[model samples]
Target chain A: MTPIALADYDVVYRRPDALTDVQTHYCPGCTHGLIHRLIGEVIDELGIRENTICVAPVGCAVFAYNYFNVDGCEAPHGRAPAMATGIKRVIPDRVVFTYQGDGDLAAIGTNEIIHAAGRGEDLTVIFVNNANYGMTGGQMAPTTLAGQVTTSSPYGRDVDLVGMPMRVAELISTIPGASYVVRRSVHNVANINKTKAAIKTAFQVQMAGLGLSMVEVLSSCPTNWHMSADGALKWIEDAMIPVYPLGDYRVADAVEPLTKRRRPDRSQNGSLATIPEE
Target chain B: MAKELWKGNEAIAEAALRAGVEAYFGYPITPQTELLEYMAREIPKYPGRVFLQAESELAAVNMVYGAACAGVRVLSSSSSPGISLMTEGLSYIAGTEVPAVLVDIMRGGPGLGNIMPSQGDYFQMTKALGHGDFHPIVLAPSTVQEAVDLTYGAFELAETYRTVVVILADGAIGQMMEPVVMPPARPVMTEQERADWALRGAKDRERRILTSLHLSAEGLERMNQGLQNKLARIQQKELRWQETMTDDADLLLVAFGTAGRVCTSVVSAARRAGLKVGLLRPISLWPFPEQRLVELAERVQQILVVEMNAGQMVLDVKAAVAGRAPVHFYGRMGGVVPLPDEISAQIDKLVSEPAGGTGFKTGSNNGYGQPKAMPAANGVRA
Candidate 1:
């Protein structure tokens, strides 16, 4: 009798083809899996799975090379931007990207990421900001918020001793080579959809031959943050967003047209439809 | 097409370009700054080539790691301090088994040592450049011409073994100007050639992931053993040394790089003075030419090891001789180069010594064993 109502349902969820069929090592409530899925979906949608290369950073995402179905290589801690720059410059046609964690990007790799952005390397960077060093246990990362308690900063983070937390997206946006720098989050379905869109736009910026593009996603770290999965998601909304606001920090003129064309109405068919006169 | 006068650093940079290097990532450091400059100037002339002045030596080495992983010839250069910054990257490159060139125009150092010519990196290059049990194929060049030839061939050897190869030069060699003929240009790997191993894309095959982190102890042990085997093969095939007058001489001098050049001049003068003096220069410091050293020790009465450092290579020479002959050492450290006369004077002193032969001896026992006297030749010390 219940079969009569089955016609009302529609297919709405499926795994991205660019992701391998394997279990992730990320802990429950961790957002790395979501971010990985978003990137895989972006690669699948853009039809770049076979022409894409990824440089996995050294932090928690060191084994990300195993998760992505595209060809990849491991970059030593904090050197993904420089590594991606080298790969992109050598083979400009390939769609190269780097996936990095907050500690890897804002701490040991600050110089590399900054230099790569300043050089306007044509690549996409997915920067996950969890505010703590997850790979080596809960250490005080460069992005650790002021007054936030971490294993290394057990006394609630002395601002006088160590500097305030870094705002990576805003800082990166100041570089002239960066064409698109946006800060997004992945918690609920709506926010997750927005994160996916931001990643796709970053990839589009690369495909369009624009300058460097990066998307900084405020992700949850339940294990390191000492919170349950739901609590961590709530913490990102209540605590993290106030310090690191979510918004597009830079959308250079070269990427504006692509962003406009990326809207759903124009992206449906194989060809991009010209906008009608207003 | 005549030979041109080029600085040691610039010549190495040009030779890398001609050897089909497609990417160059380097940081500016004393003695080797000209090399980075030359790359910046020349890379633009070649299409598809990349030249990036990295933020630091660490970044530069990692950039080479990335380019090398993509199956292209790439390299980086640095001075002593800068090369020290690259130690971690070098170890990672070794663990990943990626092919690339590292040029170290060594300066004096244990820490921020002066930018003068020094052979202080002999142990760093041969024994351990970074954490882990791995060996890089180290090439020592004594002349600008040899520098060009060695730099040109370094890329090939690196690719053949899928390991890092070092061109170990001193500050003086990097700064000196000498005539050198650049090797003929070779084409960079074609797209098809690179596709064989490069992480360019997974279009025709399964995805490839280049990594060095093997978490399991057994997995890492296997990787270590594989690296050991590769090193053993290189040692067997790439031992290079030059023997001058050692066939009929009673006294032999051991040196490398600029120190070796000075020793050659000393040998010429000693031969003119009716002294049976000869020279043996090691071109590959890591493989070390130990077999050849043993052969020469069997024939020579005494061996004198000279260098710009206090006494680095002497230990190696002593081990190879293994008490077969007495080994004496003379050196000038702290950026001071030992002049040919200074080395010749030491040679004269050793030749004039009594039957004990300068009291520096290592026989059949290992390096740490007790030293014994060299056998007297015709009851006199040869």
Candidate 2:
């Protein structure tokens, strides 16, 4: 048992101070936990844990208020954007954000999200797109892919009847108020790292006072999807990404320098690839 | 300044602004559109105050909810159909125990009824604005001046109780112009004052969480009990009503808002005609002045309830009377404002008809013949 060198092995994990020391209610193999950790890490990296306020939506992430160590409030159904806009307007210096799900954002809250983006509200939005309503037991969400089977759409979705699934990232990017709108997946190591970078950049967009920034992350609900954890992750790559493509839909010129500076020297203090807002 | 004529909606907006409203969110709806319009014009004049014309009433109410959680004096206004869309937001505001004020200049509706004035929201405001075990503190204003005063004080009441305050006026009060003496301006709530409960990014303090959802039944039940206790305390301390000539009276008139304003003339005319008739106009509709109704019931021979709705508040009046006196109601629905003469005639009909007023007798201004439509007149409101 020779003494290992300090840098001999890779570090498995370091908990973000922005997260509370409690068990999360998320299911096993769910990407919600991974995404939450990314947000926590971003908050820590930016030193904005004390100044960030989150508006949690009314889906599976309704209890997001409990996991985050930062200040938060709950918005009814698809109303996080409206709620976050309110907090930001009253206290413009504060960093305000909303954590929403597919059913909450793409379904009931389309109007609020669209209006908030259209208003060019200075806010960050982390939209978790998992095809169906996970909390309500796999109902057909507005983001449900065509030919996708769900509890409400047992015989696969009918494009003629219900129409194609909404491409939220692309749709929101079309709004003039949108400064940085991107879609990423959290199914694998490479995509997960990209998702984290996207989350950090979106927050930077808010801190930069550019415009409304949102990252629509393609996630999995293995329990609801009736698949094992690994299968669900694979499903996101195989099925979900085609219907909801991953990439930047809108990027303001002001945010390009921040993304261009991505992880140029990650060995330098931290793995987070964010430039501090001046 | 000396009393100046002000439109009801605009005056309420001005009063709310003077009450230190930092943010005002609302949708454009008839009867109350002028309130939102005035906010749009006036709020931006201030350096930091906010006025947003939300996409809909739902958005407006939620904006109010968000601002309230931030611990600012925020308000929104709408008429009936618009207010109906705000119930969910109002419920969340209530459950979160954050203060918010809403001015509902009611219009006729169970659904998009009309733009004319009506008291159809009697149940909606006092009993259930949304799905919850909570009642908002409701203040009814009968005149432009009263609307100004109530709208000004609504902020303080909401913040003091950490609950929702609804200023319940109607289209007649909103659309009509009358003399109003505006109150002196109050300083907007400083962020320092909101340090206790508001979520201003949790700088230099522990994180704050405001939400209405309680996952466990026990947790929700406790929250419900807490809300119930707050309401009960409000009921004990905040009963408000105006009594006109109830000392020596045989016939007592009960009403609120526009109908109550018209009842004043009815009382004066009856007194001039050598009748001892008094009026009890409830200013607070939720606490409802039930105790005073009981006291008045002890002295009066007959109690006549007048309202613009077909008979909503009369039910409450009857329950308060509790067989103490014969309770009779006369009302006009579908946006018809009841006239002083019509109310006076109904009082005569009630006294002449029977000795025992056990069951609630509902009479209409429309004679039994054919339910003919009356011209939508401004009537006493003008």
Candidate 3:
């Protein structure tokens, strides 16, 4: 094989140590690569590479740990939140987050995420809503559009049997402990920038010691949708985006103001010898 | 500190508290109710301890599941029927390899049998308690001290092996008061110890995931093999039991937990009557004291299996002996506790009779025949 110039590495834009050397199994022009790049950029920007831990769920993102240049653990289907809870409880100082697909996060891990949010566990969740279970051959996800067809829902998702698509960002906003919950898309350059901003905000909320924060990214699976990359972008804008509208559901401005208080250091105890004799 | 008077159930609760258990999730069940009650009353007195009264046994087990998933030392206690309800959660915990403690202060059971003491759940406990292939490290405490000691040991073992550990006792043991020396306090991991994996309010780091599902067949098989390897190592290193008066005795008595304590009395009484009888009390139900019994079976002419149920552990004893010695079973079930005097009387009857006399053969090769066709006068199986 011809050795490529180091300057060509900028095209992939991955960390030197990041383990995505092998080509991804994603279809041509799929946006999973873009989202992965954005998340990697956020980790690098925050300087949390050493102390950060990523939870990979059982989906297309199951190999998420491989792409992130940090420690990671894989969770069973839809159980990333629960597993993240375990990891966080033991390693409380480290930043923890779950990278999950729509099917894994919305369909199976609904209870785990809901309860974790309700309990105000300090963790970040990166929810990728592609409207289908992209990994296991295309199948309808909980976030699937009403008329979207997949392997499992050949006649398109029938609301009567499968129920209406879940609005995760809206649902999570109802949780009292959720300090930040936002839904952004990754179809176009503008939306991808917005999605990265939302992810960064979620991490900032956790860093501010606020509470549970989640960023739901409306993504595309072109091959699964049997559409070209450009067609998939239009499909998300015309179909997926309407059902799963993108916006910030909850963001606490009070957190920054509240954390600004100057507190006295009690560790020195006034040098102990300076204590006045009563 | 020397021994202090304590109830077995209270000791289990206190030991758990001292072991830095982060949470206690349980419902009230007779005999074992004291364990949960103690936790409720005492857990709050200590900082960092959480106690929750779940809606049902099912809820209690699931709550433990939730807390244990958080990598916290969580525990639950129940009797037979309650344990049956928690079996589903236990199977999940085992499947996920979540470390937690489950205390079963046993009572008589096939259904809601009785609230009194019984060892009937031996098979349900020692064998797989739920569907699918898995076993929890089962600790059977014969004394109040062991109950407390084993509760501490269970937590450590559970964490070490990444599996559930069951502290199996009976109503009599749970309720009975005895002198126990409390374990000294050990250093519990502070927030620093858990900073690597614990989800203490997420900081600016990466996310962590903990789970047990293997989607591929190859992944599942690898997980199962890993668990089996851990179990095999535990069986080799953690199996424990106690043998009393076995060297000179002609008859060996095999029992566990409360049944073993009862057998002690029977052995003492038989010895006073000049009948040579010994007792084998198993401390760990799983990785059972089979080899010890196999060794004892070689010397003893006959073995008497005593329990508070219809021959559950007897089958294990029989399996261990493998016809090396004639194994006889005598038990009481349905909340009917057999008195030590009655067990002694049965032992006396066996000792007084000559080999092959009284229609009961006394040889290693003797088959497990019908129970003499004797009348079930005492509500016990003949």
Q: Please list, in the order the candidates appear, how each scores on TM-score for chain B only.
A: 0.93, 0.93, 0.90
Predicted candidate 3 versus true structure: per-residue lDDT over B1-382, tens digit per residue = 9879998899999998878787887889897999999998998887766776665676567667656756678888999999997787687778877789999999977888878888888888889677777889899998899888888777878888878899999998899999999998655556565524433333455444444556689999998998899889988888899888999778888888877888888888777766678999888889887888899988876788888887888888888888877777778898677789877776766655543443432334556442232222232221
Q: What is the interface RMSD of candidate 2, in Å?
A: 0.7
In candidate 2 the C-alpha lDDT for residue B63 amounts to 91
The segments of candidate 1 whose C-alpha lies over 4 angstroms from its true place after superposition are: A1-11, A262-278, B355-382
Clashes of 1: 5
lDDT of 1 at B185: 92
Q: Best TM-score goes to which candidate?
A: 2
Candidate 1, B35-125: lDDT as tens digits: 9999999999998899999888888888888888888899999988898889988998899998989999999987988999999999888
User: In model 2, where do residues sit more than 4 Å from their true spots?
Assistant: A1-12, A268-270, A275-278, B356-382
Give each model's whole-structure lDDT. Answer: 0.87, 0.88, 0.77
Q: Count clashing residue pairs per candidate.
A: 5, 0, 27
lDDT of 1 at A197: 80
In candidate 2 the C-alpha lDDT for residue A200 amounts to 90
Residue B204 C-alpha lDDT in model 3: 55
lDDT per residue as tens, model 2, A47-159:
99999999999988999999889999999999899988888999899999999999999989999999999999999999999999999889999898898899999999999
Residue lDDT tens for model 1, A86-138: 78878889999999999999998999999999989899999999999999998
Q: What TM-scores result for chain A when each predicted structure is judged separately against the true chain A?
A: 0.91, 0.93, 0.85
